[model samples]
Target: AIALSSIAWQSGMLIGPAMAGPLYAIRPDLPYIVSACLYALAGLAMLTVGPVPRTIMDRGKGPIAQIIDGMAYVGQNKLVLGVITLDLFAVFLAGSTALLPVFARDILKVGEQGLSLLASSPAAGAALVAFVFSFRPIRTNVGNKMLVSVLLFGLVTVIFGFSRILVVSMACLFVAGAADMFSVYVRQSLIQLNTPDDKRGRVSAVSLLTVSASNELGDAFSGMLAWLIGPVAAVVAGGGGAILITALWSRLFPQIGAARSFDPAEEEA
Candidate 1:
């Protein structure tokens, strides 16, 4: 279900830019108006979802206590810790998306239309991969596949960082997006399968928090690195950092590598 939802999200991403480009050319405000309408429709659609049964917290466990418990649980679970931290540092370092404008304007010299294309390429790639996954889900060696996806993400980012040609940069971005989607699919699966139902919400909260932090902090990291060095250099170095983090995390958390699948019926890793 999560994977399918992601595919839907990616489909929206795939279509958004195509609509925006024409609307942007017609009137910049037109794109904004369309975005607002879409968001409203999304909110309305969300209301259709029925509530599911949830685990209730004990009265004795205060908010702070629950939070502390979540922290402890996350800290102790090797597979959980591995996937979460791997997501954090890999994304935190590969902040290359922060420089799309720089690449489009200064480097590629493709102007607004080119920028639109560049922005859409990754979504196109992600949407394609997700579409494939819908029909053929990955059912083996899920952990190592996650690591490999992140590694590929880093490698593509590095290529994008160095690419001067518009086509090459777009190609790299496309692959990067595909790689990121693959990793995300695996991460979400393992995290959920590994967590108990009572602990799922708590673990999910922590995972969500980590992902949110990575995106915000990642942008800041990219911007700062660009200021220190050139944008290309910053992106390139960040990609390298992501690659290094992947290798380091694999050794540190052997449990992740040993994880074979996400089958709920399975008794062991």
Candidate 2:
């Protein structure tokens, strides 16, 4: 995970500025195409790298049975369901990033350079903090940390929504990114620790799908909402939604509240 994150972070840092310089000159939407290409290449690399073992793969079940069993296991596990739902909700509502170019240009009047920063600021902050976490892993109440991080992320989104100044908005986004990094670590670690060895592949695939669905769905929602109610209002609404989601999820998932460490023993496997 660290290796993949590093590769993506470095690749984006290198390509983002250069792409923004030229593409935003022609069309602000051009960066999305470039991003799509980069992601496509990354996906290709992963495919070529071959299959990875899932939690359930060690059980010796047939391939189709393995998939079905994973689904059944996930359905039976409230903790897993809660985490997955939380991930989907948070990512779906908070991911307004794809529309940042429009926000920078039309809303904040910051132009393309600002757009580039807005687009990449969260990842930049995440990459920085992730680097720190890689060297010295956090040992604390993981669940509370995730909740706090996600809450802060929502608050930062609200701050960005209200700010007219380019620097202020960017700073808010940077803070959001930092918070999101903590959330990512907590969630991913939780998934790994809780899942049975044989079911890892299917669960991971489902998680990946959830991520793609949330991001794309969030982008569509943001774009439509912005068109309907205006950009600032849309962002503010999304922030409000994120806060509500955190509150509801906190009440619903007591296991998440019990998270003490990143140890597999902390959760049932």
Candidate 3:
């Protein structure tokens, strides 16, 4: 499994840029076609991966126990709930991603290449950061790092909302992506490291639900805000809300600051 996962990631990392060149040469829609192809390739690679775990009988805990433990853990852990809430807010305000196509056409008045750059720059920043993190090992003061990252993310969002220049907007989006990636890494690491083995699957399921909820709910929120006020105002307000939430979270969860390690056994079940 590990070897296959490594191979798949390395293959994507090596081959992903080739798609970008062709995508730029053709049309804006070609990127999606390229992405679909990459996804198909990834699925094929997964076939060579290790055996899949049995969900019904082989696992240590029954489905009911896992579900109950997961729910109970979530209900008791204020820190995890807090992280999830902040993630929700950040995702909600940052639905600016969905509006990038509109901005490329109407706001920046850029070409197909410009639109592709706008879409891909954020991912590039995140990919670079992920590469760095793999080597350096983010070990100390994770909570502090997370808070700083999210704050920067919100600030960059506001900056992107206000910028008229294409370069400036792209820069802001790049920074926002970098910040968001760091924050997400820390949050996911904390959650997974803190979750009990018996409840990992259920906890992961809840995280999945949170992701879908945030994306769909964020779309609705951004759309309504844009309609009632304006796109700029909606984006600015969302960024401001993100900053405020981060501040409040830091004040309320001070212990998270010194949390150097995550141990699920330490949690009260």
Candidate 4:
């Protein structure tokens, strides 16, 4: 089910650019206008959401207390904490997406169409991976696979940073996307399956902060680094930092690195 959702997400990313590029050519504002309408439609559709199942949660506590409870829950769970922090730092350091414009206009010299292609390349890779995982999910050495995926994501970012040719850069970005999706698959599965039903919503809210950090905060960090040094240096250093973080995390959370399967018994061991 998770894999299916991931596939859908990646597919949307693939389709969005193809449509946006042509729409952008016709009129720069067309894409934005269409996006706003779609968002409105989505908001309207949210009214149909069904009721949540009942759980043994303490309803008497206020929102702040519940949020704190969620935080404490995440802190106590090494598996969850390790997964979230790993993705947060690794993606923040990579920040490769933040530099797409610089690469398109200056580095790769591919122009507008090339920018769209570059943007879509990773989504293509991610969709392919998600499709495969839907059929044959990761069963054993789940932790190691996730760790390896992050490592590959960083390695590919480094390679992409040095790439001069458009095709090579696209290929590298594709691999990086695949690596990121793999880690996302594992991380989300751990969070969903391991967390209690009642705590899922609050836990998700907390996790969203890290996701923003990896995306928005990462962009700020990337842009600043690029201004300070250069695009290539910024990208290269970010990738290196992601790699280093992965190594340190593996050592710091031995149990996470040593995990064999997603079995509850094994996790409790």
Candidate 5:
């Protein structure tokens, strides 16, 4: 199931840009129009699906109480907390993708077509890694490997920040994407496998919150930093911060480093 999910996700990543770049080249507004139509189709398809199952809901408790309980549960679970914290900080600091327009127009001197390539490079790398992992998922030293992947992600972001050549920048982003894919897969698997069945929905809510904060908040952070500092300096500093956070998280969440596998029985024993 996990492998299939990963493949589906990567397939979208692979196809979206492959289609978007040419569509964007033909017309700047075309991509948005197509995206809106696709979204409408998706919504219609979703309407055809069955209603939400009662098993996924917590009917016994008020919404506010349920939210509080979920937060408390996450706070108490060291593994989940560690994974979430690592993701939050790493993504927050390594969000150079938010500044791609600056890089494309100013740094690389590539026009819209180049911007499309730069945007797609990371997804291409991620898709490749996801495709490989779908067949041979990581089964040992999951936590340590995830941490290492984050470190690599940060390092590549730093390289991408300093790069003047378009190809070099693309290569750096590609490497960063691969590293990020490893971290994401491991973190998600750990969260899903470790959380209790009764609290799964709430835990998923928490995960969604973290993902939103990391992506949206991180974009805001990148923009603000780019305004305060130069874009190159901002990206370099963010990458450096990510690397430092990885070191700090390694100490603060030793349990994550010690975790051997995503399998519940293996984790328990």
Candidate 6:
């Protein structure tokens, strides 16, 4: 199902821009109009979906107390905390998508079409890896593999930052995306498998919040850093920070580094 969703997403990444570029060329506002329509259609489609069944938990308290309980549980679970923390810092430091326009216009000089290609490159790489993983998932040293993947992602981002050539930049972004895909899959599996069933919703909520913070705050960080010391330096420094965070996390969360599999029983034992 994940792979299927990835395919659908990447197909849009691949096809959406190809279509949008021409529309953008004709009318810059046309793409936004089309997107709004698509969003409306999506909302309508969701209205037809069946209701989801959820497991209710008795917390014996109000919302605030329940939230506190969830936060406490996450804080106590070293592995879950570690995975979330690693992703939070790594993504926060390495996010450069927000500055792609600068690269497209100033550095790469690819213009609108090039920007579209640059934007889609990562999704394309992720889609390919997702397809491969669907058939042959990572089954050993899942934790270590995730760490290595993030390390590579940081390195690739550095390469992309320094690259002046369009092909090289696109390639770096592609490889970075592939590495990120593995890290995301591993982190999610570890968290979901290790978290208690009753606390899963809360843990998942925390995960979503972390993801949002990473992306939104990372974008702000990138823009601020770029304003302070240029886009190239900003990206390079961010990538370096990601690498540093990964090393620190490996030592701080030994359980994450030592985890061998995604199986709940193996993790528990």
Give me the candidate number with maximum lDDT: 4
* RMSD values, in order shown: 1.7, 3.5, 4.2, 1.5, 1.7, 1.6
User: Model 1 TM-score?
Assistant: 0.94
The clash number for model 4 is 0
- Cα lDDT of model 2 by residue, 1-269, tens digit: 64347536644663576467578688868878988997999899888876775332445667788678778887777767777778789878876676687788888887767777777777777767787777777777888888888888888898888888888887888788778777877777777777877677688677777878988999898889889998888888888888889989999987777778878664443
Model 1: how far is 96 from its true place, Å? Answer: 1.0
In candidate 4, how many Å is residue 192 off? 1.8
**Which whole-number lDDT from 0 to 100 does residue 128 have in model 5?**
82
lDDT of 2 at 183: 81
Error of 5 at 196 (Å): 0.6
Worst 10 residues of 1 by lDDT: 260-269
Model 1 whole-model lDDT (C-alpha atoms): 0.88
Residue 134 error, candidate 3, Å: 0.2
What's the TM-score of every candidate structure? 0.94, 0.84, 0.82, 0.95, 0.94, 0.95
Off by over 4 Å in 1: 56-59, 264-269
Over 1-269, each residue of candidate 1 has an lDDT whose tens digit, in order, gives 77688888888877887577778889979989989998999999999999987786666888899888887899999889999999999999997887888888999888778887888888888887888888898998888999999999999999999999999999998998899888888888888888887788889899989999998999999999999999999999999999999999999999888888887466352
Give the C-alpha lDDT of model 3.
0.72
Candidate 2 pairs with clashing backbones: 54-201, 55-197, 55-198, 55-199, 55-200, 56-197, 56-198, 56-199, 57-198
Report lDDT per candidate. Answer: 0.88, 0.77, 0.72, 0.90, 0.88, 0.87
The alpha-carbon lDDT assigned to residue 92 of candidate 6 equals: 94
Report lDDT (Cα) of residue 60, candidate 6. Answer: 80
